[model samples]
Structures are given as structure tokens and as C-alpha cells.
Target: MQNNKRRLVRHELNASIDVWDAQSDEHLGRLANIHAQGLMLLSDAPLVEERLYSLRLTLPQSLVGAGELTLAVDCLWVKSSEDESRHWAGCHIIDISDQGLAVVELLISRLR
Candidate 1:
């Protein structure tokens, strides 16, 4: 069996939080789950693995008193669903502001 090397536990998000391309403002996907280090995105198209992406997450105003959070992420992997209707991409958080990290932590807490 392959050992899991992940140090952080991922939390599946209940709400539909849209993920966007920060540069182009294109809709990339919805956040499926998140952790302190990374997140999983459910998208209509597969993201290129090993590529770095600037993502913007639209957070609920009531949750963190913020409209959006931007993050620099490195795409780790991408997989298609069984029915091939959607794609899921795993990404590593490469860069984020202190405030962004704080918001992410708060979001994880609220998820639990």
C-alpha cells in the first residue's frame, strides 16, 4: 500500500465557492475541498499538472467579511470523474498573504 505523506487534513466544503483565474478572471472551477497547504477543485476542464496558477476564490461575505481571496497555487494533479462529466484538480498553495492564510484557516474551522 502507498503511504500517505500529506501532513494536513483536507476539509470538504459544503458551500459552492467559485474559483477563478486571477489574471484573466475566468471561471476555473468550484472548491471541492481545502487544507492549510492546498485544495481540490472541481472543474469542467482538466487543469495542467505542474503548472502554476493564480486563483481567486469568492468567499461568502458573511463568513469572513471578505468578497474574495487570491492565492498562488501549483497544480499537482488532475483526474476526471468516472462519468467524465467533471474534472478534479489538486493544487499546492505556493503563495498567499497573511490575511489570506488567516481567512483560509477560518474557513476550515467553520467547515468543521
Candidate 2:
């Protein structure tokens, strides 16, 4: 088995938060799922390969509030062969602030 993340864990729907387009930036789609290292987002928009982008994962229901948590990430890969017309962007968080890490951990814990 290969572990690409420092501590990867799957988060259930209860723990999952909705991420949005901070700048109304054009993205392929909304975030579908997240792990310790990164997340997968589905979008109908087109994106350049291997581009780095900033995203804000909103914690509207959580104690973290509806604030924006900035994440610097690069596209690890993209899948467009699915039956759905939308494409999926597989990303890697290049940098995550301490707060971001805590939030991710909390989300993971909720899954357990």
C-alpha cells in the first residue's frame, strides 16, 4: 500500500463541509470529498492541467463558522471519463495552515 498523505482518513457526509468559489473563480466543479492531503472536486468548467489554485472550504455548520480557509494546492490529476459530463479534479494541498489541519482532523474524527 502507498500512503501519500501524512495521515489520511475518510470523512463521512456528516463531517463534510461545503466548499465554494471564493472569488467566484471558474472551477470544474464543487468539492466532492476530502482527505488529509487533499480533496476531489467535480466541475463542469475546464481547467488547465497541473495548475495551482486557491480554495476555501467553508465550515458553515461546524464551530469553525462560515469563514474561508485558504488552501494552496496543485492538481494531482483529473478524471473526465465518468458517465457524468462534469470532470473531477484530484488535488494535493501544498500548504495547510495549523487551523486547516485541525479542521481536517476534526472532520476525520467525526467519521470514526
Candidate 3:
């Protein structure tokens, strides 16, 4: 059963885009889907629920005119994939700059 409680629709990317931990610069995971208010990540490990994270999204320069965007996000939930080889995390964007938001909007539009 799938939960359909999200307010904003998320767009899945065809290309690979990596998400990283901004402070540690560690490669956290790949962006599974994204929207203006939130994003989902596919990682090797599960993220702690209800914890805040500073993440860096690396985007193609041609798509956003910039290389990366930093965001503060709160992990809402996490679940292990059925195969148990990966984890999916749902996170809500808590903070972002106006420019970063613009880039996100643009990316969503292009994805659509």
C-alpha cells in the first residue's frame, strides 16, 4: 500500500543526480524525486527520522545555471527497500534561499 498524503507532487528524474551532506561533503545518496517543498532520496542506509539535515544537491549546470544547491531538510520517514539493499527517505525542505528555490522550480518545470 502506498501513502498519498503529500501536498506537492514530486517529479522523478531520468538522469542521475547525487545528493550530499553539505557539512561533511559525504555522498549521501541519489535524488529519487523532488518538488518545491521536499525530495526523496535513495541511499544505501536509512536516514534517522525527524532529524534535520543539511544537504547539497548537485545539478547539471546546463539545467540550473549552477552546479549545486544547498538545502536544510527534515527527514520525515524512512523505509528499507523490499530487497533490503537500499533505503528510501522522505524529507521536507525546511530552509532554502530564494535563488535555490528558483533553481528547484526551474528543474521541476524542465522535468515536466
Candidate 4:
């Protein structure tokens, strides 16, 4: 079953990310967004659909450092936005730690 609760708690933040394309092993674009799921990368770049990836995403300033958590991710799907300017990849993160969960909780608190 899908996590239907969907937790409307979403945040927008500018962060740094390092993504290596699994298929070609090349570094892709770097960008950021406010997302509890990590970061909503902005790019029209194509990802290996349904493939798993390792992502290093910088936490928001509230976390207070350049440190980042490694996320094991699987791209659920990828679609271009209405403007056809960029693609937003819907992803699911795997195996998050308690500390990472705590940090996300802090971010949500700020949102409220």
C-alpha cells in the first residue's frame, strides 16, 4: 500500500547536491528545493528510470553545517513540468537514520 497520509508538511530550501548518473557515471546538474524527501532537483536531465542511486544532499542551514546524509534512492518516475523547462523526478529514499529523521522533524517544525 502507498503511504496515503502524504504528510502535507513540505518545505522549500536551497541546498547543494552531488548526483552521479548511474548509466554514464557522469556528474549531473546541481540545484535545490525545499523537500522533506531531501531535495527536488531541477533539471531536464534524464535519469535511468526505476534505477537506484546514491545521493549526497546537504541539509538546510538549521542543521548547521556542510555535512550531508547519503540517501539510497530509487527514481519512481520522471516528468517534465508544464513549462517544459525542466524535469522533476519523484523519488523514494531508503534506509534513513534516526538522526536524519530528527533533522527532518526540525525542518517541519519551522514550517508550522
Candidate 5:
């Protein structure tokens, strides 16, 4: 059965990100709200839907202690916001380390 409930709480963070195409290394854009499962990304250039990208997101030192959270994410969907200055992409977290997950949890807890 497909689980409909949210597995993790999403924390809203208009945080900057270093995103790039996993294969080509072309820069993508910054990250928006993030959760353990997925995230919203804002990009000047539209990202191809249904592609995996590598991301280096640095949480505020107060939130994550220090260092960047690196992970591979699958782009699920994309749409241009009303203003059309940026495209919002939905992404799913494909892989992350245990330590990364721990830092994310701490960030979420603090947000709550």
C-alpha cells in the first residue's frame, strides 16, 4: 500500500544552495524549503524535469552546526512561478548520509 502520510516534517528555509547537474556539473540554482523527503528549488534557468542533480546546501551554522549537506536529488517536477522570474522545481532526496540526516533533524526540531 502507498503511504499517504508525511514521513518527515518539512522545514521552511529560503536557504541558498550550490546545485549542479550530476553528470555535466552545470550549475542549477538555489534551494528553497527543504525536508528529509523533498525540497523546492528556485532557478533562473529551468531544470529538466525528472533528472537527478547533485546539491551542496549549507545550512546556517546555527541550524546545522557547520559544513555543507551534500546529496543527490531527483527532480520530480517544475513550474514557473507567477512572476516568471524563476522556475520552482520539486525534488526528492535520493541519497544522504546518516550524519546529514541527523543535522537535518536538528534543524527541523529547532524550526518547530
Candidate 6:
């Protein structure tokens, strides 16, 4: 049997947010779901596995008070969906600033 070992509750989300590589400032993809620990990202191409990426997730004005949230994330896995038109990547967040953490908490509360 498999164990459900998620530490944080993951909220299913459909909100669209632009994602960028924090170091190079390159646009990576769109964010699909968010949790306190990590996020699921959807992209046109697969990201390199086990790579650490500094990400900037631009939150919607309606959702997160019109600002971008900065985070350092470790890519955990990548897989192609059934449609094969896009790729999904799971990432573990390594760091978030104080203000960003506050915003994320508020967002999580609202989402819950």
C-alpha cells in the first residue's frame, strides 16, 4: 500500500499566474495549484528534473493583491499529460520572503 505523506493540504486551483525564472528572469510557464510548501506548474515543455529554480509567481490582482511572490523551488518531478500538449511539473519551495509568506497565507486562508 502507498502512504499519503503530504505535509500540507493542497488546494486544487484553476487560477492562472505567470511564472518566471528568478535568476535569468525568463518566463517559464503558468501556475496551476498552490500550497504552503509547493506548487504545480503547467508548461509547454518539461523542466529539468532535480533542478533548483528561483521562481517569481505573479499573482492575480484579484487573488493576491496585485504583486509577484518570490520563491526558491526545487523541481521534484515532470510528466506529460494525457493530452500531450503540455507538461506538468511538481516543485518543492525552498524559500519565501516574509511579505510573500504573509500574502501566501492570506491566499491560502481565502482559498480554504
Best by lDDT: 1
Indicate the TM-score of model 4. 0.60
What tens digits encode model 4's per-residue C-alpha lDDT throughout 25-84? 566545344345644455667655687877655445555453665556677767677888
For model 2, residues 1-112, the per-residue Cα lDDT tens digits are 6455536654444544555555665333565777778877767764456988777776646456646577878887776755757777778888888888887776666643
Shift of residue 31 alpha carbon in model 4, Å: 6.8
Please estimate how well model 6 matches the true structure, expressed as its whole-model Cα lDDT.
Answer: 0.83
lDDT score at residue 99, model 2, on the 0-100 scale: 83
**Local accuracy of candidate 6 as per-residue lDDT tens digits, 15-82:** 66789998998888988777888888999888889999999888778776657888999998898889
Ten-residue stretch with the least lDDT total in model 3: 103-112
How high is the CA lDDT of each candidate model? 0.92, 0.67, 0.91, 0.57, 0.74, 0.83
32: Cα error in model 2, Å: 1.7
- Where does the lowest 10-residue lDDT sum fall in candidate 1? 1-10
> RMSD of candidate 2 to the true fold?
3.6
Which is superior by lDDT, 4 or 6? 6
**Which has the better lDDT: candidate 1, or candidate 2?**
1
How many pairs of residues collide in each model? 0, 4, 0, 3, 0, 0
Clashing pairs in 4: 11-34, 12-34, 13-34
Better of 3 and 4 by lDDT: 3
Could you tell me every candidate's TM-score relative to the true structure? 0.94, 0.71, 0.93, 0.60, 0.74, 0.84
Model 4 residue 22 lDDT score: 42
lDDT, residue 35, candidate 6:
85
By lDDT, rank the candidates, best first.
1, 3, 6, 5, 2, 4
lDDT of 2 at 61: 65
Per-residue lDDT of candidate 5, residues 1-112 (tens digit): 7454667666775445555665566667776767888877878988778887787765676665576677888888898978888898888889989897786677566754
TM-score attained by model 2 = 0.71
- Give candidate 3's whole-model lDDT: 0.91
